[model samples]
Target chain A: MSKKVKIVAATGCPTGIAHTFMAEEALKRAAEKLGVEIKVETHGQVGVQNQLTKEEIRAADGVIVAADKDVDAGRFKGKPTVDVSVSAGIKEAEHLIQQIIDGKARPYKGNSNAESKQEESSEGKSAGGFGRAIYKHLMNGVSHMLPFVVGGGVLIALSFLFGIHSANPDHESYNEFAAFLNSTGGVAFGLMVPILAAFIGQSIAQRPGMVAGFVGGMMANTGGAGFLGGIVAGFIAGYIILLLMKLLKGLPRTLDGLKAIFLYPLFGIFLTGAAMYFVVEPMTTINEAMMSFLSNFQDANPILLGLIVGSMSALDMGGPVNKAAYLTGTALLSDGNFFFMAGVSAACITPPLITAFATVFFRKFFNEQERNAGLVNFILGSTHITEGAIPFAAKNPIVVIPILMVGSSISAILTYIFSVQVPAPHGGFLVLPVVTNGVLWVVAILIGSLVGGFIYGMYQKYSYQKTK
Target chain B: MELLNKNLIKMHTNFQTQEEVFEGIASLAVEQGLASDKKTVVAGLANREKESTTGFFDGFAIPHTKNSAIQKAGIVIMVNESGLEWNSMDGQPAKFFISLLIPENEAGTTHLTLLAAVSRMLVHEDIRAKLLTLENEEKIYEEIKRFLSENM
Candidate 1:
């Protein structure tokens, strides 16, 4: 009789939040379904649980390290191991287990006296594989930056509720409380880009990456390349530090401390700074041209303009394209084009609200957990949190994203037609009183949401029937 | 001194659970005059188990404790034809239960070295496979001693 395959796994995330536990449960369920004997250890905020004993490690056929942050993989040395992000652990646990079963996984040679030589030589060959690794590093940045964005963006909107000029000391209606809120929000916003770059770098080269990444982000800010510039700088900084480590690898063991403290930071900053100045200059120019194009776009046919902007906003759902549209709206707000922001805001809420609506209408299309998530999306959407729709879109991107984009386009066009204007950069329904043609703004959002939800629900129903 | 002597090894035992296997081993430790009391030794093993399960994959468990109830550091090795149900990480029953009892002050010194040695010994597939097939306690002890002396 063939022996039963046995595997051990560890799951962890930076926040030690839902994803860590979710991945653990998902792996367990998948293993059970696949008839594979598996053990999972979770490195959570509470610390490690269900730790793999030394005996278990020795007996296991393979290991899976599903984590966002660094994990001690030393124990799995000489074992076939698959190291991946926690999200992959949640979504592709079966695939990972199958890889181990098929003997496709590489043997993990951790940093031990005998193995470190092989590890270093292999590391020299590949800095890291592309695709998944790149996404993991980028997410490390985005996850850290999100809290600042939400806190700052909402506070800035709240200050506007007191009046657009209430935070200005020279204004007739200047309020100390409004000023405090505005300053605090501004401080958070100021740190957002730097934090994003720092974490991305940290994911790559640890502490040394953070120093270089922070500098790169500051360069982006001063250089006016915005968030895109920050992303480029982060990648450049991380890769440069990685290269430095590789180059200085032959250094004596006693000088290892000097490499991290002096050589890495010094060389990393110098290279990243040069790249940002020389290479990133064109990016800032393009960004400026895009802003100008957006400003000039007001004279174009309103319906066509609304369609393009709305589609762009919904295309990636908080990704680069979405950020571009949102940034354009914020820039135009400064230039006093309030209606541009109104269209942007209307489009932003459409995806999540439509997702919620679809979930409620076509009950059979969603599972219990998803239905609950859909319910939560309603509150998130109403508050202008477009990220609420991300889970739904991520699951069925091909069908869901296109439908969401169409609905968002329709919403934007309607908002433009109704001449709705929003002075604030954020706050969905909460800042409704400050919106000119507020009632029409609400009407445009509802109409777009209903249209999008109906189309998505019909598609789901048809697919479900076909599958049945 | 040889750790897994004939006196400490039990072959083809019928214990059917982790607790039961541990109880049988603790009593053996007392019978061999290596432990002060059977009850205290069993309680120590149970307490250690509560802290973390020592059950490993491929039907092996090493439940251990460092307590004042032990007169000397010793290992009790039990081999069962039928595996005992254990709340192991891999969810597999354990057929080989190696219980260790050490005097409190000597916890981290000799006891830890022996534990490490045992761990290192078990990591080899050939050694484990050979050990599993040996039905005689004297042969099992000889096999373990030869492997450890050669490797360690």
Candidate 2:
């Protein structure tokens, strides 16, 4: 048939220590043994070596991605690919090459339209771990969804600068320009969840997934299901389309075009729509209930709520625990609970300030290096960079973390007690102008930091004495 | 290439276990000024091992690490007198140890060429046998260096 088959292989391992290069060598040797031309791309710790060009991939008969990590399989969309672990490339290199020669390579159904359906029925042709594949698809969707969120969020935030209700024509503060910007931002923001779902679908089943995902996302949005609903809709839509793709694999080649454009979309959307319809309503209710429940707790007792928020925010100092607190506050903020976010920000701002204060008060107890570092913390604490406190907390977490949390809690409690409302999700004191009772909020944070700093300095002095 | 030399190769080395081998490598690399400290190099190798075994079947293991602690790129070969547990593909202990240490900042071409060449040589059974059975440190050094120079 062909003069000499050309194969392109990518090899990678978790550490890029030894197996990656070994696999590359094995693949090259095997290709030579089989009398075929081959090019090996190695994803090593040193980074990608002997990278395969687009022209090479297009010209090659098959692709072998022997990777324990993501090598951007999206590039080899329509090419026949044998995706396997790196170990296989080393141990069964010749077999993999031979499979491609024997026309056993199944084309990757990337963004490429339906082509090379002859071996579509082949079992496990594009072998990969299931959870990783889905995770990759989800990340693809989220990345595409980000620009819309940022652009829309900034515009919306800017629109509110005129007045809170300036976008409403009937409101006293209504401005036509404000309305225009707000609506435009709303348009972009509205597309965020839908785009997230659509791209996720597209990632899984190609174009057909896009169609089903968009339709499902629209249903989720209309049903008031919000972010969680969009996620559910996207996954369901993608998988249903995938199942449909498998079912329709045995159809005649003549019907390939018909199946992609007509059959797949029609069934994919209908099924996704039916499934998402039942899911969206429940998700919306759950979302509302969750928000209201948290808000109710906010109303019941400010002290307990403040302590929880403060402790959680200061616990990890920008690690996952801190992020969880921030994200939860952001979620509430999205639902118009500015009070909760105000307390969250106050707590976040307090920890760094505590460290800054500790260095100042306990100067003799601390070394020269720590005192200089403490001065830098003043700038860090002012802008609400909680990570600035990490070095201090990391020094003796057992003694420092609890003290910082106490200070952070006191600040959050004061902000809550004063009924401070911070409109922006983040930006620390930078968003103060828009904040109701902004000065009071700053007072709450300083009081917390002052108390925290006092305790920290005392502890440092005590530890110094004990060590001596 | 200064990647491998006679001085880098050691024949009939005495190492009972992986830790002992690492201890040997750490001291050698520090003495040669290829690394900042023994702990960093030893930790780097241990960390790499924790992620995945560097062992290839048929009595070969190539442990490698690229980090800021490394002062330069270099290779060290130790033909162990006794086999050590490596969890190799063929379920056999690895005796021939080829460790590659790379600086964090290098463009990667130097080590990549060396690694590729070493792996290419190891891939062929006959060549592997020849490498394993090489008489002394000088012969092993010359053979490995020749392979690297020719391929690189």
**Strongest candidate by TM-score:** 1
lDDT of each: 0.75, 0.78
- Compose the digit string of candidate 2's lDDT tens values, residues B39-103: 88988888787666778778898887876888878888888998997867776799998898888
Consecutive 10-residue window with the lowest summed lDDT within model 2 chain A? A113-122
Clashes of 1: 0
* Quality class of the docking in candidate 1, CAPRI style: incorrect
Q: How many residue pairs clash in each candidate?
A: 0, 0
Cand. 2 Cα-lDDT: 0.78
Write down the C-alpha DockQ for each prediction. Answer: 0.02, 0.18
TM-score of chain A of 1: 0.60
Model 2 iRMSD vs. native: 9.2
Tell me the lDDT of model 1 at A156.
Answer: 67
TM-score of each: 0.51, 0.46
For candidate 2, write residues A150-259 as lDDT tens digits: 55645665676676677889989899998888899789777866887888788777789888998898887677665446667787888898788778767766787798
Q: Report the number of the highest-DockQ candidate.
A: 2
